[model samples]
Target chain A: MDTTQLLKGVLDVAVLAVIQEEDGYGYDIVRRLRAAGLKEVGDASVYGTLRRLYTAGALSTYVVPSDGGPHRKYYGINTEGRTMLAEQRASWTRFANTVSLLLTEQHQPTATIRTIGDKS
Target chain B: MSTTTSPTLAIHDFAAAVRAALSDLPSEDVEELTDGLEADLTEQAEDLDAQSFDPGDAVGYADELRAAAGLPVRGKPRLPSAWTANKLRTWASAQRSNLTRKARSTAIGSRTLDFFISLRPFWWVLRGWAVYKVIAALVIGNSIASTLPSSGTEWVLLLLFVTVSVQWGRGRWLPWSWLPPFRTLVSVCSIIALPLLLVLATAWSSSADQYVEDYVPQGLLLDGNQVSNVFAYDSDGQPLTGVQLFDQDGKPLTTVGDPNATPWVTTYAADGTEVILVPSSDVPGRTGWNVFPLNTVDSVDYYSQPSGEPDLSTTTPAVPPFTQVRPLTQQTPSPTAPPTPVPSSAPPVAPEPSATPTPNSGGDK
Candidate 1:
């Protein structure tokens, strides 16, 4: 199944995690995410996410002038972003564990069916 | 490998195209989504290792950004006919942004831009005042005596309008979707209203001037009716002739109740004979109609004369209302009074005689 739809919900946390490790500009963060195996990420989506994070006070930005190109706007995660990432991290771990258990026991009947069988 | 301007310029062009695709959005929203877009695109091109990397569809990119950033989608017109207006608007916005970019490239230019931006509040207040005055003058037909507020109610109305305008200027008072078209309407109307307001102001000012000129009372009046002539008598009840009058401010009272009055008038003498009256000439040539006890002239002499000064030779002493009023006596000055012998007796003698002649009896007084 395509992960693009799933990426929308967790893009915020992923972006915050990438910038929390080190300050990076728009394309730099996108490259880091792609190298970390989420190659389906759209460039504009990452740019928009960065802007939203900055607007929401999770990221702080500063301009660094490049030698022969437009000024690069670097984003670094702040205290608020760290707090957000922690919460989302905990929620995602719980969800992943549940999904992992459900997928591993594919042959087992659901709890509701087993209960009905026992009653019968 | 050396860096060339080609890739950077291409990235800038791509970013500009993206901005154009999103031109229908509010300016600040467009800026927020695309502020550092050129740098990002350049990096993406470099990473792809293609000498001529395609930026692809800008409209698609704008939509993705809009969705991810939670901005409202750009509204499309319902009918084909509406596209013309949309196209025109988009073109105007592009021109404005292009001008702004050119202006911001230099230090002085950027500072000038900042200075103008700071004056926006003042412009907002001015716009509100203009709108209020225009509505008041046109719709309510309220007379504008002056531009400044002259009454408490006017001040309150002005404050209310200014508050509303400033809120609208700050983009706070209305829904975002409604603001663009309404703002455009207001801007166009204000432009049209400026010249209209000037015309109305000129008309109002002229009418106000005419009103002032109309109500000013000319010459002298007693109980609302003109005093066509003045009369004088001594304390001894004898009529006083050639009595030149001066008001309290020492201004010579020379004009008559009406400038166009007939030159000759008839009055009864003490012997019940008719005498003709004409305004006495002062200084040999000028008529001093306000001089008390106007000269008496023979009716034949006045009627037979051609235009110009009446025959000064035929002028005679005016007839008094009475040959003898009750003679008034002056009290002797007390011994303690200053020895300069102040002439207080003359004033007291005049008032008693002046009160006896009633004005309504016609210039006979």
Candidate 2:
């Protein structure tokens, strides 16, 4: 299944998690998320999502002027973002466990009945 | 390897489009969104794979930016208008549109209908003001409440008025009734009415001709013995006052009433001046006191030279009548009347015999 739609809802958590480990610029955050296996992440989406987090009080931003090319805008997660990450981390784990159990269940009822007879 | 200026300019153009799309956003958001974008584009341009990473639909980027920032779409931001000014403008525009639409209607009657409709709000506001004033007078307990609408009355009245207006604006009929189609008729008719009412009031209200007659023996007679507060006398059409009243032959007439009656008396005009009083009727078209002009004739000729008292010198004016000085008015009624009577009294007693002597004797006593 495609994950782009799934990515939209969780972009805030993903951005905060990426920047929470270390302060990062917009493009750098996109590269890190892609390297970490979110290949479908768009560069502009990361830039947009970073700005949104900053605006939403979950992230703090500061401008660092470079000697050449573009000045870098760096974002770092604040306490609010860490708390959000914690909650998201817990919910994501719970969701993964529920899905994992569903995938591993027996396909046929006869096998379950034979196992039950042998146990009896 | 450096890129050419054209591609850099194109990147700048792309950035500009995104900024334009975000124009309605707060300045800080625009800055935050666009910061370093050109630099990032330039950096990406060096790598062959990313060099042509043109944003296919750059305007879509602005929507993304807004959504990510948890803000409304760029053009959909609420306009920054205060509630009162917003309401006023909405009402004004509604009325304007209503007027234009009505004016465009093909029927001739519709134009007049629109005119009355346009003026309805003017009546509403005036009605509101008048109603407020009347209520204020009754509740605030003053013959005239303080003129300012908000003042003198309790805020409860204001609240009540506001509630009614809001309901009326929403098309409630219980409050505002159907006004007559002729909204301005009362005022326009009143404009025509005042002079007409005055004509009627003047015509039958008072019997104007009851006191007027074809002939009265005297001209301009005050029906009563005393007339006070007479302002001016008309000559031809020019108004004249303080010009001494003179009879047809020009001798002054003195009116003796209250010591305070206007000093229109003849002797107050001059001493040694002969006078003939014309009855108010003799002047052809005029009917008031008619007096003659003053002439400095020797009183010695008018009255027999005083005898028996040798004080004749004391009684007579040292300024003999022969001198032709025409005196200008001294403000009060001139003292000429008192002196003339004094001179007539200077003759010594035959206190009872000669009628003239007795007249003087009585005057002297």
Candidate 3:
């Protein structure tokens, strides 16, 4: 029931999608995710997802040294990451539409409940 | 740039504590997990202020990072129902890592801590000694004596315990430091060892005190044996009465037994008459226990006085070894001072020569 629990399942796609638009470092990705209205996303979760994706060869990294602080490791989506992101986007659209249809049809509860129950 | 200086240092320390908390992981994995942690933490600190990033927050961030990466929890996993236990584990972990971070924040503090860490072997040996002494005192009933083992078995035990403790300290024993239960047990035992070691030290010091003090003789001694009561005879072999004796140094010779010991001694006369030796007091309030042939009392009168002091009125003088001893050459000390008159307050001594044979006047010798 916790949004964080739901966020954990889709955080990889979110981080990949954020990096797909532009290369970003750990905190940069977290900020972009938050600015995009996923305010409940954890800073460490984004960092961890970036690392995980980079290790999986779905992302590439480069170090950007700063004047006063440590060097930032920026992540950018790769071919494999973009292809995976496209697939997930299509799947999300289908899933979201299906759920939206079920929710908006108020008088079709018996039909919707029967459909979900049968799948289960 | 000027404002970012302090926050940068704090970010470094926070990242270091997070790394230390996850030290159980593989070095490569830890590096991967925390590769750019300082850069991230520094940016976060600049926006929120470094005060928001406490040690617990750093540890929680590390935990979340690991969980999201599908790694096992830092310590051995527990049942999900143990929520409070998990909180306590996180709290203790944060405190330990926080202490380490604070200590290493300064050069002098870090050096001092490293020096103490180098002396852990000495402490391990001392802890082993303390454990041995406690077991000897409680289980083997040995007095706290020496740091060095006294006997063959004790030496073996001491060596075994020291080896085990040192191995444990060196991480050769109980290598599963990542297990929280084992770590907690070790911490609790180390805490208990502090007080137990104090007790051993106190007992050891008191035993040393006993050794340094001179021996105090309890009472009269004859031939290295305790003399219960003294009896004296004159050169003419006649039994003496109301005799006051002293050692060569003029210390009054009292009974060898404890005055507070049980007050009755039963003796048998040659006629097989059962006689109980009772100590008699002379003056109204004081007992002349140094007087030879301590006065006696009848059983009835002796038992009637519950205070253990024999009634002077009903008391009689003790019988001697013989009614008449063979004569020895009689001699008298040349009068250096006039003979002193006997005190009138002295109890009366009735020398009734009963035909019943005498028993040893040294009661319960």
> Which candidate ranks first by lDDT, i.e. highest?
1
Across B177-281, the per-residue lDDT of candidate 2 in tens digits comes to 433212233334434544544454456434546556433432223553322112222322222323346457774333333222322222311223332222223
RMSD of each: 17.1, 22.6, 20.8
Query: Interface RMSD of every candidate?
Result: 1.0, 1.6, 1.2
Q: Candidate 2 chain B — worst ten consecutive residues by lDDT sum? A: B316-325
Best by DockQ: 1
Flag the better candidate by DockQ, 1 or 3: 1
- In the order shown, the candidates' DockQ scores are 0.53, 0.35, 0.43
Positional deviation of B284 in candidate 3, in angstroms? 99
TM-score for each prediction?
0.39, 0.37, 0.37
Query: Which is the better candidate, 1 or 3, if ranked by lDDT?
Result: 1
Off by over 4 Å in 3: A110-120, B1-6, B49-56, B77-365
Model 1: residue A118 alpha-carbon error in angstroms:
9.8
Query: Any idea what lDDT model 2 has?
Result: 0.54
Q: For candidate 1, give the DockQ.
A: 0.53
Fold similarity of candidate 1's chain A to the true chain A, as a TM-score: 0.89
